[model samples]
Target: MAMFVHLTAAANTPRIRRAGIRADSRGQGGVRGVYCFPVLPSYTLTHQWLRELARFGPKGALSAVHVRLADAQEVLVGHYRDRAKDAQQWLTAAEAVARVAAQPDPRGWEVVVPRAIGAREVHRIRAVPQVAGWRYLPGAHGTRPCTCVGCRIRGEYGGRRLRERHPHPLDGPPPPVPVLLARIEAAGDPGDQAALLDALHWFGLRRRGPVDRLARLAAHPDPAVRRELVWAVQGWSTPGVAELLDPLAEDPHPDVREAVADVRELMDEQES
Candidate 1:
């Protein structure tokens, strides 16, 4: 599914002129930088560029392409400085930036510059996507992670500014527990089910549901299912949950015992 977004011009930027220029470039529409949110659980980076295309009209017909730079384009150095020798990371970052710069559209442009950089350190250039051949330059800038979740995970490239990408998880956010649980129950792929369950547990979303649903999970036959149920019940301490939790606490699986211990601590706290 496409990531939803609101794309707009960076104040006072003129809509491309239409007169002699082709009507397509005449500013009937605009271009903008696509934001990518990788931290959110979907692991699907929000396709800001596609969203921009949707908003600005067809890439060939749009008039102005607005790029949100001041906030999103400065984190390329730290992500690469130390890991220069790591080919995979370097290549991934390189490819993402290249893909962004090489987009085929005349109505848009990408505004890229270094953050915390002084005028003397580098020549700051804004590469409109249609202009072609744009790249980043390096310099001393107090860089931060890209504010947009996708950029944070995917990283950006500014001409010569080769920075490192952050190591945050790519999944943006977990689907609501009920949603994930239902998918797990319906999914034929064990890996998919396990991945969802693990995500639910990792994000600490387990507390939002009923202990009984989880207790019933303990006997699900599939060891993986039983294992995840253990995590789901790990911290449950609702008053009537003891009956549901006690058996799993002594279940043959070490995972079950560990979950029981975890829940016991919750019960102990409630008693205190």
Candidate 2:
């Protein structure tokens, strides 16, 4: 009867593993590169949105607060037709700002938009410390409950209402919903249009929801509206929605094509 003693691998195996890791680190296949996704930080993304909003800021602050720039380049490329001199100018400016803001580093810039604040007030607020990134977003602060048109709509349609007018410690009472909506809508700024659409989308109004009013805008002459419409439709997935987006997929604008791709992803997600 022969019993064999178990033999163990060399203790140097651990050191070998460490060396291999170190070697991998020195090359592109290193640990750092393993998780190397393009680091588009939230702040940078927000900066892009802000720059797009600024293009629509010739109106009130609320307008400035609402432009969505998730795909600024796509939007520009899709909708920037030489329709009007002013439109071209605005598009040019928006594109330039977007290019800068979309850069990896936006340098801690902030644009603030307060409820019912004017240009002077915005300038004053921008000077505040810890407000380095303060951006005066156009539109009323939808924090606290208020009787404004926007708020009223919010209360009526935004599900169940609270028993009393309790305000948030940080947000206070929101401005009247109607006022906010009016301000957001009356501001013809393209940025404002985009921003309002963004707000409506976020407010759970996308698709067959309360924000269905926006769908009519899908056919707007402005390609910008068409682009935003594509984005908004992502939240709405019903039968025939694919048919609605098919035309947009073939849109002459590259941005529209890209928008189609985004919406397609949403469709794919829903299917999955």
Best by TM-score: 1
TM-score for candidate 2, please give it.
0.29
Candidate 2 deviant stretches above 4 angstroms: 1-207, 210-215, 238-240
**Candidate 1 Cα deviation (angstroms), residue 207:** 3.0
lDDT of 1 by residue, 85-181 (tens): 3321212323334443454431222221222222222222222333222112122135553423323212222411322243335333446767665
Prediction 2 global C-alpha lDDT: 0.37
Report backbone clashes per prediction: 40, 29
Q: State model 1's lDDT.
A: 0.37
Each model's lDDT:
0.37, 0.37
Instruction: Superpose all Cα atoms of candidate 2 onto the true structure and report the RMSD in Å to 1 decimal.
Output: 20.8
